[model samples]
Target: MPRSHWLDPLARRVLQATGQLPPARSSATSNNALARPEPALPSNWFLDVNRGSQQQWRELPGCTDDMADLLVRLQRGGVQFAAADDLFRLLDLPTDLAQLWAPHLVFNWYGDAPLQPVRSCIDVNNASSEELTSLAWPDQRIHGLLRERRLRGFRDLADLQERLCLPASSVEALIGRVSFGQRRAGPSLPPRG
Candidate 1:
């Protein structure tokens, strides 16, 4: 079928993927990179909600360091934003501030929350040895993770991978399921009276 046969965007994308629909003809806008408004971006221009780096999140105007950290932290932990509403609600952004970011945001994932894979992100920096062991990783990886963290905190995926020398497959598996943050410190029990 021709691309125009599918009126809906989702149907078109799905059909295109299945090779049932011909791709739409290219247009003058194919070379959009030259006129991209954001100059700091390395390659691709859009900031995708599903899978984008922390640096991409920071490119948005009015995106604070804390906000970027929270966004990346939450996303890395398996939280997916369905719409601008999700971002506004989770981040507690004022309407005006959300308005500023609304246009720049792109949602790559399609469909409801339950329909997607349900993987809660594990904070490698703070998860208990038990929690880390419960996952598919072997005992050696778990021990290595805990031992390395004893020396210092993991910074990001790259930092963790470099520090631990994780195999490519392990790092790939860890992408959305792992995050790094300051270890939650607990107060010691008060001295007995």
Candidate 2:
């Protein structure tokens, strides 16, 4: 004979106020903790100066409206910053501010935060005519200077006029863009007896 399930007459009334529910099962598929999205991270120092919005720059540590404006102007002006020192020189800011902001700055026109060991400029003493032609300077003027430089290198900016017979105004204009430093020399040999 099959067993029959049955309830007592008072079972419904006795259990009326006592709610009953199935026990919760541990779930690997369902989330056990609250879900939260990650926050947006801030840009690095170089990026903050090169590409940051005016408001973002103002929000940077120790940055004022004047400072932020100048940074934006310098970036837009196409100035190539080779290091934090260049930024300090360009802005003429207080030493304290430069020191404070240096950690967040980069030395190149690009926004990447790579540390550049040397500031690059056109090496006038070693550049080929092809390289000189790439510059904004006048082709004819550069050619004349190149010929003179090949014969005997320029001693200084002042020498351009004397050595190549270039105009004073042209030399003055090119001085800021060109580097007069000698090329990096190879390792020296030991002194001979």
Candidate 3:
């Protein structure tokens, strides 16, 4: 049977209003309209990667206590995830679990939280190794960045990608979060106890 016949007119209207149904599709040579594949509605639990607590993560489908703890650690370390795939990649989460939680994951995605802004960024040239870890930037990458910054230093965003061998997509995702300032390079000193 055609999709239009699947639901009565009133049901279609209500679904459309709530965005629970996709827009109807029309056949090429006929006035007949069929419903497109149903779009997945937004999940009730949209967890923000930047601000979600361990408890909140544990509440997500398929998320275990260890996984939630890891997530919270990443957030505290200053990792600014661009998307769900990034999170999955960083943590090496199982494919099935990632899929189960994909619809509910978001990076810096706004939702119920306190009335304070969250900043997701790090200064490549000035940030220490520990600070760089916040974005889950590889340890080798951090070492390379620090060594290079001390030698010649980054002049602009392009310099960051070129010096660090970062991809264009990574640089683009950091547009607002990055600062290309002229802070002088200094000795790589250990964090004082």
Candidate 4:
């Protein structure tokens, strides 16, 4: 009753050579249609189609029937590499696959600015002593300036420097790094005690 029992060594070899011994089945049909010889894997396999055959020889197993149907649909639809990355991400594919397809992912792939340096905006009015200390300046002078600003409100940058008795050149140098802005005006200062 078993199909293999009917096959002898020579007969099996002959059948295999002629592509006749294995009776055509759905799996075989699907495999035959999808599988093609891939000579070598490329550096980034998903991106370099020419390096590896366009054929997807192995199917992702343990997929539900619905998932299998979806994969077939995706194959027929012909996914762009970028789109494929998103699809795999949405489906929560393995990390290896995600990394493999990351180069192809369109979300943040390429743009005019290849690299952009980070710049931070410092709030002069609300920055803590620790935050102010992080700047390239004397920590004592910064602390003194912050104290002066807290006691007597600064109308402008010049007023702030004057209140703290700091040098005009120092203030000028720090202008680009520092920013002055009005605070949100908390609770009307509790009617000044």
lDDT (Cα atoms) of all candidates against the true structure: 0.65, 0.53, 0.63, 0.47
Candidate 2 lDDT by residue in tens digits, 1-193 = 9664467435654565452322233564234422532222244534445556567776555567776675564444433454555456445568867666666664344643433333345677787666677556676777676656656666554454456655434443443456665644432222459
For residues 21-108, could you state the per-residue lDDT of candidate 4 as single tens digits? 5434587666876686322335343433112222332222223445444434333333222234334533456876555544533333
Candidate 3 residue-wise lDDT, 62-177, digit = tens: 57777777566545544456666556654557987787778887777443332222257567678767777776567787788777887876765556766677764455455445
Stretch of 10 with least lDDT, candidate 1: 110-119
- Candidate 2 matches the true fold with a TM-score of 0.32
**Each candidate: RMSD:** 17.2, 23.8, 15.6, 21.4
Clashes of each: 0, 2, 3, 0
Local error of candidate 1 at residue 175 (angstroms): 3.9
Evaluated at residue 166, the lDDT of candidate 1 is 69
Which has the better TM-score: candidate 1, or candidate 2?
1
Please report the candidate that would top lDDT against the real structure.
1
Which runs in model 1 stand beyond 4 Å of their true positions? Answer: 1-59, 63-117, 167-169, 184-193
Write out the backbone clash pairs for model 3: 77-134, 78-134, 79-134
> Which ranges in model 3 have alpha carbons more than 4 Å from their true place?
1-42, 109-193
Q: Against the hidden reference, what TM-scores do the models get?
A: 0.40, 0.32, 0.36, 0.31
Candidates arranged by TM-score, highest first: 1, 3, 2, 4
Question: What would the per-residue lDDT of candidate 1 be over residues 54-149, giving only the tens digit for each residue?
Answer: 777877766778778866755555555656664665456788778667777788764443232225678888888777865578888788887788
The local lDDT score (0 to 100) that residue 101 gets in candidate 3 is 75
Q: How well does model 4 score by local distance difference test?
A: 0.47
Ranking by lDDT: 1, 3, 2, 4
